[model samples]
Target: MDSAVITDTKTSMKAIFSDFKQLTKVGLSLSVVFSSVAGYLLAIDVINYFTLFLLALGGFFMVGASNAFNQIIEKDTDAIMKRTQNRPLPTSRMSVKIALTIAILFTVSGIAILYSINPKTALFGAISIFLYTSVYTPLKSVTPLAVFVGAIPGAIPFMLGWVAATNQFGIEAGFLFMIQFFWQFPHFWAIGWLQYEEYKKAGFNMLPMNTKDKGAVKQIIFYTVIMILVSIVPVLKLSGAFYIHPITAIIVALLGIYMLYFGVKLHRSEENKDARKLMLSSILYITLVPIIYVVDKFLH
Candidate 1:
């Protein structure tokens, strides 16, 4: 190719990669990936390095694809919201056609890699992507219940990795899914409370639309309490597989209390700043729990 042609090709490649990055919501998606990998490691009896790597890779792309489709479907609403207005789709950095094409390609590739590991994993991944993009994305503007709908698919990755490793769904996978499912309420509600105005502007009714009088905050505290209790379920069982020793149980309990402290403070304060703080605390709790899970597994 001529020099100008080569330069143009390189520029095009760069633009495409940048758009793809936005599609993936790379940072957020990768964090989901970390928890999935942690789940796989914690659940697996025998560690196959290659299988683990593929599981993470497949899980990451599946989540990335889900996010891409979500962005595409919400592009119009996203343009109206300040938080999402600059995203590739909203900014016209990429066309919806291109975004959809990438979404389909990535979703297929992700599911294929997962299928190589196990059929059940591939099936669950397909369902996650479908529920997130098709169901949750469109529901955002329609009702506050979108948060609950979104959580179902959001919680899949952690359990997904477990299914990939064990090729079965049982109590272990159920616990992983439940912890993440319950955690989402406090995590996203705090975010919803903090960004209620922005979300309102975009026609989204987050934070229990009508009741401003501590309903959302009370719900956050309620869920946080449940999350704390769920975190310790494995400790009572003596099977070294999921059981935590007394010391590790204390560590997990303290972590839960720390999160609970923030949840209660936000409940009482009901201030936007406190809501944001609680949101950050929720993120910290979720991210750290996987580490706690892995550590306690080894410690015991």
Candidate 2:
């Protein structure tokens, strides 16, 4: 084969891989998989590597499917938004039919993989995809409550692990769900506030007030308080099998307070930089809280 042809092939392959990465929102999806595995680790006492692998793989594909569907649904709007304009679908690097096929394949494979663990896991997997694609995607254009609706699916990955482990959706699982559910509001609102200009070019209204103003900041603070309160609930041992150590809860509380401090800064200054700080803090808080829970359980 000609060297020129060989180089072209390699470049094409790299382009294809990069496009798929963007289409799947690989970095974001991996964090979601982490959330699921963290829940699985929290729920299971003994290590089951096979089940763990399946949970992580299924969770990734589930998130991948949702992202693909989201891009496909909002290709036009996403194209208009600076944050999403370069995505494969919006950039026309990949055709809609191809993206849809990938989404369908992911959905089917993800659910099947989860089903191997148990029926309930598969059910939750399907439900998350359906809610994300069917409901939340459409709601984004209509109302700010879309954020509230989207939170339902966003919250599930953590609790999905417990269901995967025990095949039961109990108070323990519900507790995990609530923590992530409230967390979503502030996390997403911060993003919305920061991207308010870009979002104005699109057709979405994720912010409660659709503006970076006092009302929006207040809503973010309210949800931040609720999220912090929920994070401390595991100390109550609301679930017989899933409580965190008191010390860990203390750590989690302090992390929440750290995040809220940024929220307060944003409230006081009403600065875009403050919103960015709050967003970073929220990410840090969510990432650490789960680790604290899983680590605290193992250490003590």
Candidate 3:
């Protein structure tokens, strides 16, 4: 009986972790880590191992707090959508009270660690949580423009990590923020298009309610063009620690154009699968383009 009880306790612990994963949205949190690391790396003259570790740990909690609060706010809508129906809060596997407590605790702890780094880093982190939870979370159901609002907080981790490293915000950090900010349009629109049906069922107005693909596709291509233009801005000048040769910038520009071509083609095709493909391409481009920037910075 004692052995059986031990096994049951361990099983329960595993189950609890699964529920916490749902609350934290682990994949999204890790994406936050990637951007934060990229920013931290770009801003620093030499990487400090301890500082990097602290940034990662604090960033994880900040992201987790945002995600947890998002889950709490959307628990009702989550239950309505097939994609989110089984989440911890929606499925009643965890109480709303418990989720709120976790969210607050994570947010506070994250902000405190960031404060230890610098005032600006902590301020930005607190703002991100506020915007994500108080503004973006509810705006999802009310307007399609929520994507714009969401992108502000979403793109912040990159610059937040930079500020933590450099202790100052300037053109260099602004450029980094712009890259993530502009990338969000194509990335999120593709997601909005791909998940329109599910989102509609949940009363989330992600895509335009009109079902018109032309305007949406146009926006994607436009942003892709803008992204390519802005992405190369740092290459034109000796801006900061970041340095990219014109040739590398051209290569990155071509990649952006390659992505833009798909966005335009998807618009013309008007196929759901093609739209999904564009979304995946957007994901790949955003993830890789930063790596290219870091590599170019090192090589040039």
Candidate 4:
């Protein structure tokens, strides 16, 4: 082969790989995988490394597939939004045919791997993709309730991990789902608050009232309160597999208080900086709550 041809081929491959990264929205997909892993760890009595690996792989592919489909569906709208204008689809770095092919492959392989774990896990994985791509993607422009609808699929991965570990849907899985479901409100609202103009450019109404009015800020406070309340529920001995130690409870309460402080600040000031702080605080709160729960479980 000619040296020039080889160099051109290498460059093409690198470009394709970079586009693939954008198509997958790797950071967001990985975060979803992390939540799934946390749920698995919280549920498993015996740590199975192989099962954990499968769960992470399946979860990543599932989320990646959903995001790829979202980008493909929103390619035109994405091109108009500053934040998403450079995505592979929007930038023409990748073709719709190729992106769709990749999404289908990811969906098939992801569900198959989850099925290897259990059918229920696979079922929920497929449902998450369907709801995200078919329902949430289109609904963004239709109603602010899209956030509520989208929250269903967004909240699935955490509980999906527990379902994979125990192969059952019960109060424990429900509790995990509820915590994430409620958490989405404040988290996404702060994002919607910060990126209001960008989202408007894309015709997305993600905020509760479709505006960053006092009503929307009030809802953020309401949901944050509910999220904090729900976060400590596992510590209350209401269910069999979901109780935290007293010390862990106190620790989680402190974390919730810290997050709630930001939520309240956003409510009081209605400033973008406060909303940004609440957004970051929400991330920390979600990340820590799972770790503390799993640690408390192991210790007790």
In model 2, the Cα lDDT at residue 167 comes to: 92
Each model's TM-score? 0.93, 0.98, 0.95, 0.96
User: How displaced is residue 225 in candidate 3, in Å?
Assistant: 1.2
lDDT digits (tens) for residues 116-162 of candidate 2: 99999999999999999999999988899889989999999999998
Name model 3 segments beyond 4 Å from true. 208-212, 238-241
**Native RMSD of candidate 4 (Å):** 1.4
Model 2, 300: alpha-carbon shift in Å? 3.1
Instruction: Show the lowest summed lDDT stretch of 10 residues, model 1.
Output: 238-247
For candidate 3, report its TM-score.
Answer: 0.95
Task: Give the lDDT of residue 116 in candidate 4.
Answer: 98
Find the candidate with the highest TM-score and give its number.
2
lDDT of each: 0.84, 0.91, 0.86, 0.91
| Per-candidate clash tally | 0, 0, 0, 0
Clashing pairs in 3: none
lDDT tens digits, residue span 116-231, model 3: 88889889899999999999999998898898899899889888878999999888888888888998888888888888889988888776442547888888888888888888
- Against the hidden true structure, what lDDT does model 3 obtain? 0.86
Q: Which regions of candidate 4 fall more than 4 Å away from where they truly are?
A: 1-8
Q: Cα lDDT of model 2 overall?
A: 0.91
Model 3, residue 161: displacement in angstroms? 2.0
